[model samples]
Target: MKVEKNISLLPYNTFGIDAKADLFIEYYSLDELRQVLKEHKGERILHIGQGSNLLFTRDFNGIILHSGMARARFLDDETVEAQNGLRLDDLIAQLTDMCYCGMEKLSLIPGEVGASAVQNVGAYGVEAKDVILRVNTLDVETLEERVFTNEECRFGYRDSAFKHELKGKYIVTSVVYRVKPGDATKTREEIIETRNGKLPKIGEVGSAGSFFMNPFVPEEQANALLAQYPDMPHFETPQGVKIPAAWLIEQCGWKGKTLGGAQVWPKQALVIVNANHATAEDIIALAAHISQSVKEKFNITIIPEVNYI
Candidate 1:
């Protein structure tokens, strides 16, 4: 278990943020991770998957463990197991090739399978929790291996028990997904149509996906907004009516707005992209500014979906 010191973290994160870690270790297997943990017992450890959803605020003093054990295998006709480091897009591609259908809705979401379960990542009316059968995790307190069923995961909108009650208490090792065969041509067409209509074209530019989760407000609040702006779009969720954060941001005239090297994507207000040499601070500040503007103008607060480390 070799550990590097004072490692630059810029290459690790998707935002291309410049940050450092005092101690960094990349694990290729579960045994390697256990050995490292044994050697550095009682030390603070941050588990990082692909670094897509993370924003590093400053240099970390403790160890940053990068899970590089990228392995994916089909368990059965309807089940696939993937290591924590397996990229979400890779998994989607594999499923697509196999004619599997459930993951198509999340085709372009960045990050690893482990992080998807952590946040119950969702898009286009589908969520990770919907297909996850079980999650393999290493308990931090006892160092015991356990499998958590979907129900045990306690999934919610852009939230899971892993993000709150069990924040750093467990290290997810792998995820098991239940999928079924589908018509490949039809699925491909659907994906193409959705992308063409709702998202930026491939290779267009920079982004960490959607910047904020659509804020769920009371029906009354939504109706009041509808009264003022009758064409405002909203969708009903299990919680309440979810007003698109992008629509609200667009209404605030933030789309195509640039701040330093960061810019609200011209194509999607829900996305704040790094247009040039943008730093983590710059992106964060722009998001805050947008949030503040929306809150002050519409009396609603927009919460970021991206995780800050």
Candidate 2:
């Protein structure tokens, strides 16, 4: 266990907000994590992986626990297990290079392996839930270990039991994934090229990827919007029709719109970039502005996918 005081969180979070945590601790193994839980029994803790899907609204007044485990091993020819702290993209690269086929579409998504399960991160029709075999975790309060089957996670669109019924109750330690054997190098290259075209380069702009979940509305409501705008794009889900937030934001004329130092990414309206050292307040204000506009125009509520701290 390594504990630091009053740590600057700018490099830790993808948003690049310079928020400070009252205390920051990192552990490398499950045993160490158990010790941490035992020691900081009553301290408020925010457990994170890479902090890619998080936005710090203000300096955190509690301890922030992170994992430093990146070791991985194969259970078999088709099954691989990785510690929670491994960068998600790094794991993907290794799998693809070894000719694994299942993770190609999800390549380059910013986050760590543990977050992949927590958020059910997805892209190009593949979600982490699809390939996950098992999740290993420890109860925060009891420091007891439990293994959750994939079905137990109860993954939904950008959500899982971890974000709801089980929120703050467990710390994910590692994950096991079942993958197929085949080369996907070409697919990975194409995905990288496409992402580069749509998203800002990592060092160039700071963002939390897509800012909002595509709002799902009933068929009738979706039809009404399509009646108004014939060219709008949508997809059908089991629950309802999902509307593209970018299309709605663009229609509202918010593309490239600025609030303080935040701007809607010109290339992708769904992303809010730190255009000029934007504070967390700036991003929050801009997000509110965008949400309000979309509501007024389409009568739908688009909620943020990013976890605000």
Candidate 3:
């Protein structure tokens, strides 16, 4: 484990923003994590994995904790236990090759295992919460280890308890996922093709996948909008009617638009890319502008899916 001071966050976040962390620490084992937590009891901390789905808005005035552990083991023919720091795609590849079913739809999604349960990461109609059997965590306040079943995680659309009511209360250590032995090759290929068509390649462009969550609106509001835009795509959810944020952004005339190094990707309006050497402020400003335009045009508010640190 290494402890460093004033480390650049550019390498730690997907946005490529050159923010700094006051202190940066890495732990390779549970004992090392406990040691750091015990010694730095009251210090502010932010945990990270692969630096995906987040934007560092400014130099963090706290410690950034990262776990170095990465491992995955099959508990049986149909279940797997994976350590938190494992690259999500690596795990998916291994399981798919093993003929593990149901995970193929999530192939190539960015981020790590630890974030799966926290973000309830979803794509192509499948969500992490759907496969998660349980999540293992260490309670930072009491240094006690605990487990939460899928039901206890309070899984919702692109949300989980870890992100809301239980935010910052626990540090995820591992996750147990349920899988099956079946051919997943065809489905995986299709999902990949669909994503590649709309999303930028990871290293080729700087982005956090979808920048905005699809906004849900009441039936009346959706019907009103549909009257004007009969072709506007939507899905009905228990919350309300889910409106595609991409369509709204496109209607506001933001596709491929640029501002201060940030640009709405030409291929996908839901994505905001670091077109140049974008400062954190540049991305923030561009996002704000896009959001404002959508609000004015549709009378609907779209929330950011990316975490701002």
Candidate 4:
């Protein structure tokens, strides 16, 4: 276990926020994690992964936990169990190298295995839930391990039970993913190329991937919007008509637009980047402006996918 006090969080988050934390702990084993939890029983604790999907609004005043146990092992020919600290993309790359075919579409997505399960991170029509078989977690109160099957996770578009009813009650320790024997190099390469072209490179640019979730509107409303803009893109699903938030933001003339030190990514309007030493306030203000414009133009309210810490 490694513990530090009053540390800069710049290296931890992909957004490059310079926030500080009162306490930062990195546990290398499940036993160490349990010990930490037991020691800080009633204190506020936040378990973070790569911090890719988060925006630290201010210095954290409580414990911030991270895992240093990154490893993956094949459980059988078709399943693999990966520790929480393993980078999701790194695991995918390794699997692809070994000719695993299930997770190629998710290649290059930022975040770790635990956050993948918590956020249900998705891309190119594939979601973590689609490939995840089970999630191994630790009950915060009891310090006992528990396993949840995929269906028990109750996954929704880019969301899961971890973000809601079960929030803070359990900490995901590892995830088991289903795979098959097939060369996925081509698909993985294409995905990486596509993402690299559209999304900002991590470390080079500060961003939290997609800033907003695509809005789902009723069929009638979608038809109404389509009438006004015939070229509008949409898809019908069991939930509703899913309209890409990127298109909505672009139509509202937000592409490449800047506010304070933040800017809407030119290639992908779905992303908000810290263009030049942007403060959390600048990013939040810019997101609010974009959301308001989209809401004004179309009666749909787009919500942020990034969590503000």
Candidate 5:
């Protein structure tokens, strides 16, 4: 429950942005977090796990709670339980070794287990909500532990109840995922094939995955765009057609474009990478410029998937 004052946050975030926090503490257990919360009763708090999905806007004025406890175990024959602090990439690797197929698509996504369900993080056709059996949370208001089922999570396209109704109301402690046991070699081969002929590598660069969620547009609008660019990728969702944000961004000539020390990845238009010593403000400005250009050209406003604190 020890709190450090005026902590530098340069290494905490994936963007490597320089920022500071008035109070910062690393909690290794739920009891430690409870005790700290009781002692600092009136302080504003921000819970962070791996700090992948966040951008610091300025020096924080409140407490920063870093979830540092790491634990994972097989709950049963078809379920695995993991603490909030477990890295997403490590979890995926372990699951793949165990012949669990559903999480391989999310192999390269950054962040911890706790943040995955918050946005229903997805890639290549699969989403976190698709395999999550339940989420264990500590209610901030009542300080009670509860397990929410997948349906209760209200998962939508890149959204869930955690981001809407329950935002800032609970701290996710752990998650249970439903997975299957099969042949590891076959699963690895399938995943490798689906990677667009790329090798399986980790920690290649600084990124938080796709910066923007794919924009959902009406069928008519999607059809118009499809007619214009026959190869534009899209998927049919219940809402309408989910158009790839990368397509619009590439069409607008933003790929490989650099602003200050931030640049859109040349290979993946959807990813904004830290080309050098990029500041959070630099990345934010580049994203805004890209979004504005896309909107002006395509009449669609792109929504960022990353959280700005």
Candidate 6:
């Protein structure tokens, strides 16, 4: 276990916020994590992953916990278990190199293995829920290990139970993902190239990959909108008609637009980038304006996917 006091969170979050935490701990084993939890009982605690999807609004007056255990192993012919601290994209790269095809579509997505299930992260028609077999977590109160099946996770579009009823009650320790033997090099490379071209590179440019969740509307409303925007792109799903938030933001002339030190990514309007040392308030204000414009022009509400802390 490693402990630090009055730590700057600038190195922790991808947004590059310089927030400070009263206490920060990184545990390398399950026992270490349990010990820290017991020692800091009743104190404010926040568990973070790669910090790719977080926005630190200000200094945190609490304990920040992180996992240092990074490892992965094949459990069976069809499953692989990975530690929570392992990078999600690194795992996908390894799987693809080993001729595993199931996760290639998710290549290049930023975050850790633990956040994959919590966020139900997806790209190019493939979601982490589609490949996840089960999740292993530690109950915060008892420090006991528990396994949740895929069905029990109750995954939805970019969400799962971990973000709701079970939030803060359990800390994910590892995740088991389904895989198969097949060459996925071409697909993985293609995904990596495409994502690199549009999304801002992590560590180089400060931005959450995608800032807004794609809004879904009733079929009737979608039809009405289509009559007005013949060029609008949309998709039909069981839940409703899915409209890409990128398209809406672009239509509102947000692409390449700047507010304060933040700017809407020119290549992909769905992303908000800290192009000029943007503060959290700058990013938040820019997103609010974008959302407001979309709501006013299209009567659609687009919510941020980034978690503000």
The Cα error of candidate 1 at residue 35, in Å, is: 1.3
Clashing pairs in 1: none
**lDDT against true structure, model 2:** 0.91
TM-score, one value per model: 0.93, 0.98, 0.98, 0.99, 0.92, 0.99
Q: What is the C-alpha local distance difference test score of candidate 1?
A: 0.85
Local distance difference test, per candidate?
Answer: 0.85, 0.91, 0.91, 0.96, 0.83, 0.94
Per-residue CA lDDT of candidate 4, range 1-309, in tens? 999999999998988889999999999999999999999999999999999999999999999999999999999999999999999999999999998899999999999999999999998899999999999999999999999999999999999999999899999999999999999999999989989999999999999999999999999999999999999999999999999999999999999999988999999999999999999999999999999999999988999999999
Model 4 TM-score, 2 decimals = 0.99
Which segments of candidate 5 are over 4 A away from where they belong?
185-204
Model 2 off-target regions past 4 Å? none
Q: After best superposition, candidate 6 residue 232: deviation in angstroms? A: 0.7
* Tens digit per residue, CA lDDT, model 6, 1-309: 999999999999988888999999999999999999999988999999999999999999999999999899999988999999999999988888788879989999999999999999999999999999999999999989999999999999999999999999999999999999999999888888999898999889998889999999999999999999999999999989999999999999999999989999999999999999899999999999999999999999999999999
lDDT of 3 by residue, 1-309 (tens): 989999998788777888899999999999999999999989899999988899998889999999898999988877799999998888998888888887778899998999988989998889998899999999998889999999999999889999987888899999999998899988888888888888988777889889999999999999999999999999999999999899999999999999999999999999999889998899999999999989888989999999998
Quick one: RMSD of model 3? 1.0
lDDT of 3: 0.91
- The residue ranges of model 3 lying beyond 4 angstroms of the native Cα positions read none
Residue lDDT tens for model 2, 1-309: 789999999878888899999999999888899888888888889998888889999999988999999977899998999889998889999999888889888999988898999999999999999999999989998889899999999999999999998999988889999899998999999998999899977767889999999888999998988898889899999979988889999999999999999999999999999999999999999999999989998888999999999
Error in Å for residue 30 of model 5: 1.3
lDDT of 5 by residue, 257-289 (tens): 999988898888888887888888789999999
In angstroms, give how far residue 1 of model 3 lies from its true place: 1.2
Against the true structure, candidate 5 has what lDDT? 0.83
Residue 75's lDDT in candidate 2: 96
**Model 4 weakest 10-residue run by lDDT:** 188-197
